[model samples]
Target: MNRRLFPLFAAALALTVAASPASAAAPADAYADEVVAYRAEKWQSAHFDDAEKAQKHAATLKKLGCEVKTGAHGGHTDVSHRCPEWREISLKTHEKAHQWEDWLKANGFETRHAH
Candidate 1:
């Protein structure tokens, strides 16, 4: 590593990072589109108190473009909003509840299963 080459190496690295896809941010419209797609179908986030209900709900969610797994998060159906892993929508705190409600309504969903 010559002293003169050090600056060139750094510049190359910066260029590489700038061109990398991971360095780019996902567009907000993309998230909004996915939310709209999720809302276009019947989306229900509820507790899987019954195994049968959980299975049915998972299947329904899968049909609506979700990648569902075979389990619950603390007795609730873990529905992955986008990624492959499942997420619990049941642990809604006071502020989280309002945010969830607002998000649902904004995405054209009713949040009908917030019991």
Candidate 2:
């Protein structure tokens, strides 16, 4: 291959990868808004090998409404904060949703289709 064409080919490959949808998504958007099961948030890292340091981290987490617990670490105890993860709420079936809509109308609440 010609040296000039080699550079152009590499540039095209790079552009292709960058333009892909997967590469375009941001970190927070990685977890889609799709409905999913309810699960506890996994323990996030505090970078502490000492229980005392971890306790301090846990204190901060607790202040922000996280439930924390400590587990066995190699040299000490590992503290991890358990935060609640948001679960998308949706009525799966249109029949059930319509039932609720009817009930809402009977109760004097206005309900309509999403469209």
lDDT values of the candidates? 0.36, 0.38
**Tens-digit lDDT string for candidate 1 (50-83):** 6765565445344434545565667655433332
**What are the TM-scores, per candidate, against the unseen true structure?**
0.29, 0.33
Candidate 1 runs further than 4 Å off: 1-36, 39-45, 72-115
In TM-score terms, candidate 1 sits at 0.29
> Candidate 1, which ten residues in sequence have the lowest lDDT sum?
29-38
Tell how far residue 25 is off in model 2, in angstroms. Answer: 32
Overall local distance difference test of candidate 1: 0.36
